[model samples]
Target: MYNSDTTSWQEVLAAFKRIWGYDDFRPPQGEIIRSLLEKHDALIVMPTGGGKSICFQLPALLQNGLTLVISPLVALMENQVQELRDRKLPAALLHSELPTWERKKNLQNLEKLRLLYLSPETLLSAPVWEKLCQPQLEINGLILDEAHCLVQWGETFRPAYRRLGAVRPALLKSKPAGTKIAIAAFTATADPKARATIQKVLQLQKPAAFQISPYRQNLHLKVQTIWTPRGRRQGMLKFIQARPHEAGLVYVRTRRDSEELTELLRQKGYATAAYHAGLSPEERRQIEASWLGGKMPFVVCTCAFGMGINKPDVRWVIHYHSPLLLSEYVQEVGRAGRDGKPAEALTLVSEATGWLNPEDKQRREFFAGKMRSQYQEAQAIASKLPTQGEVATVAKQFRDGAIALSLLHSAGQLEWQSPFHYIRHQSGKSCSFGELNAQQQQFQTQMTQYLTTRECRWQFLLQAFGFAKEAAGWRCGHCDNCN
Candidate 1:
């Protein structure tokens, strides 16, 4: 292992230049890297384009053993791994999408790997977990990329992340004595509550946290409330027409919306395609490649479109429908103007009234009720679950049972043995169903308020994400409200 205490900053700088060709480190990149090299866990909450990747990537290269990056998306993992491989760095990824031969090859080459990326789901799978637990393997660090997903999706969409808190201890049991592996989580948008959730979920110990303000002066924020479906479509068309051939992305809430809007734009002579999770991996990759290579001018997509995509010249982003959460809104819009040039983001919301748009309120209420039911269901099942059992075993007995286990883990009623297994820590303990429900309602209300606010959009976002001090006495003249 590299003795970070004895290593000089000159060596670090040299490695940085050799790998990334950057003459100097960004503001907190150096500090964040040092924290990891010294084996201190960290949580980084820099805005998009703030050079978050380098903080972990650079240190991984400088370290001896492998760095395991737990990312949420397969595309994101493949993108980063491919970039590293292109640079002749030792990087590989493991995911279910890989062909049989490719998966075998990656597993065989694990010992030669410097950085390995995998989704939380894949990392927790039996095959991968067994390989990682082998005593001969040495892991330098674990990185949770796009860490806010742990907070956003842990309870519902992906429960494997909730069990990650147990990973360190379980892995330690198999490793040689005194083997220490540091952990670091990186994200573009995590408020105070989300940060706390990440720390608890990942078992980060007194982690050195680095958070930058989410404000971007170059990205103008705007919201328009359309009273009818036709009006919304027309408004979107007008917005797209105003931009012409510039590269941009149109975000919709569902696959149906993506398909419908793509056809509408195609009929209007726009070079575009629809992208959603419903497409096969090859199809998604083709669309992504075409968009990235400039063959396609724009894409009408669901939220699955742009996580780790580094398109600097994207001039605009339009939300055909308002996102359910402010975090989603901030992340989706932050994709534009990454090159620090002027860009625009506009969200089309439904006008709140009986006749024109009942779907918006109905959707919000449906989601809120779904969340409440999930919490209630989790509480009900907590008593019936075994003290120690595999996740798959318990999941077979109930619908969305993985989510139930995750909620119990979060509320301290259970503990994970690994991603796929858990141990009941406290039987018959009441999980904080009411508290979680209230928090969910608050988050929904905040998004609704953001759509209706007449104040500076950026200011509203900063305040919403727990940056009250920064939002105070500040106004960006670029936003619609400020203008």
Candidate 2:
């Protein structure tokens, strides 16, 4: 199974070793790599440290045309592009960070590149679409990294990923029919519904799906129920104090919480830094580098952080807030113990907040009500607006409620400038009642189950994602719940 002979897969692995200094492929790497090279759409859900980049990077080198990787993080894109270039691979990143002239130069060099990394936000832009529509632009494959965010892991909505279906059409418009572009979606977390959402959003043609389990035996999974704010803070402080100089991550629910917690940790004489989306791109990059390079052992960040984080020695992952869902909880915990060593996964659930809150209940109810309102708004706007400007004006008012617009648009209740912008009428002027009811029911079911489940957290998690439990190694002896 682990072949070293000169087959196409072996040849690719050999080049991989030569470029990245690795002698063997990780388990499932060989299978996924071969599938990608054969020009097939693949949905891969591997845990952290599972060698996801090589699955697409190696294929990019061996393919005839440039490979396009759609990522969600600017820092991640730049880091990946830089890492490839360090190894002398023909790679570049296309993100807003580059100046106009620099971006033009990068695009000009596209004909010579093997891999081009782009933020999904940038890739969904109209100007980018114009370039992709060019007759000369050649993309052999599309690799969507952290693809689960496109569906489940995203907040109330993910507008950028909602536009991926249109991206394929735009790319296909310029390329030859025989080119055969392969699409690959990779993530560390995705439930069954999320997987289905990805397939529908991308319009993949019966894509092959592979999911490795999230349970890591080496990581001790722990949950501590803390009722008081001061008690939770003290518990976190004590945990960090116990570890001293070890690396760790603290994931809070909001940006403000990340900052406050980081400051508290620092005041208590620990090396800590705050990280969240609110930080400048440069500042975020600096904080990430400091942690990754071992300059700091503790970084308090929001759930928005860690999309593409690759630090292998994160000794602990502590959650200050109850994650919106268990899938998110598992992925956040997976970040620790990546170095094949003992690590800690701790969630300090505030008993007052409990598993379900009135606010959460209201938020879900509000989302449902707003979805209906936005659908009607889109329908009304579509009837009146013929030009793009009128459609855009109305869409802007509803931008904060984009999820409502997106679901309506997907359900054939309205149209938009693109999947990302503008509004238009459904071609049929009618709704698919069956489809609408089904999606609404499905999303609601997931939301309810995630909040109410009483099973072993790990078992519930694996089953939600359609992954089978392996031989038992999940009961870490140190977890508070275990004792």
Candidate 3:
């Protein structure tokens, strides 16, 4: 085992310089690294482009055993693994997209791997989980990259993340006595409630929490409320035209929107492309490469475009449709000003009218209603579910059954046996379905207020995310309100 006492901070610094070519650690990075090296679990919340990956990557190298990094996006996993490999580090990634031969080779040589990056889905797969549980395979830590996705997508889209709380205990059962693996979660956008959800879902044990203010001084935030689709289009065109030669991103709400906007922009003689999850992997990679290589001036994309991208010169980001939640808005806007140069973020919200262009209000109400229905559906299906069953089995049995089970788990009504299997818990009082609906409505209301408020945009965000102390007396001269 590697001894933290013998490995001094100077040694860590030297390694960081030699590997990452960084002369010094940014603000809280050194502290986080030290905590990990000392075998302490951590919850790190930093803004986008804030060296989060390096914090865990460096320690994984300094540690004795393999570090399993759980990531949500396949592109992100590939990007990190490729970068590590480019540096001649022993790193590999396992995902569904991998070629058969490469996947077979990596699985066969698990012992030689130092850093293993894989999605939550692949991590809990039978073959991979079986290999990881072996007594001989030593795992030093588990890093949850982009941890907010645990709260954002855990219940609805990716049910695997909801079961991660049980992973540590289950893995411990297979290891020899006295084996402890530290877990650290890293995210660019997670508010206080989201942070609590991450801690509870991960079952973090007295973790060392680190949070940097989400405020970016160089980012100029603005919101434009429009009464017509044409007005929104014209507003976006004007914004893009003003920054003609610069690189920026225009975010739309749906894939259809992305395609339509891309076509519209092209017709108006702008160089842009549509990016969303529906495209093939090769198509997505090509578009991403074009954007990063400065070939594409701008991309009209959905929310899938900017998770692991590290373009330092993103001059601005325009949201054609307001994001459903404030956390998502913060993350999308956080993509700008990475190089600390002045950047702009403009969000266009549809005006709430009785009949003409009421899309935004209708969308919010639709989502609120959908959330309520889902909660009711979950409660209705909970009793009929087997006491012990696999997530895939339950999903196959009923529509959105996986999500239902995940909601129950989040409400402390069920316990996961593994990622796939779960055992229902019996409590005197069942979960409050009404509470879930109320929370959904509350989130919708907050977003609505943000769109319509005349207050400082930055202040509103800080307050919404439970940073009221910081928001209290602060006036950002860069935001639309202050300007």
Q: Which residue pairs clash within candidate 3?
A: none
- The number of residue pairs in model 1 that clash at the backbone is 0
- C-alpha positional error of residue 58 in candidate 3 after TM-score superposition, expressed in Å: 0.4
Give all TM-scores, in the order shown: 0.96, 0.85, 0.97
- Span of 10 residues, lowest total lDDT, candidate 3: 428-437
Candidate 1 lDDT (Cα, 0 to 1): 0.87
lDDT of each: 0.87, 0.72, 0.88
Q: What does candidate 2's lDDT look like per residue over 136-225, in tens digits?
A: 777878888988777652323555566676666667767888767788999888877778878877778779878898767687766665
When 1 and 2 are scored with lDDT, the better candidate is 1
Off by over 4 Å in 1: 417-420, 425-430
Global CA lDDT of candidate 2, please?
0.72
lDDT of 1 by residue, 203-236 (tens): 9999998989899989989988888878889999
Q: What does candidate 3's lDDT look like per residue over 209-264, in tens digits?
A: 99988999999999888878799899998998899788899998889999998998
lDDT of 3: 0.88
Query: How many steric overlaps does candidate 2 have?
Result: 3
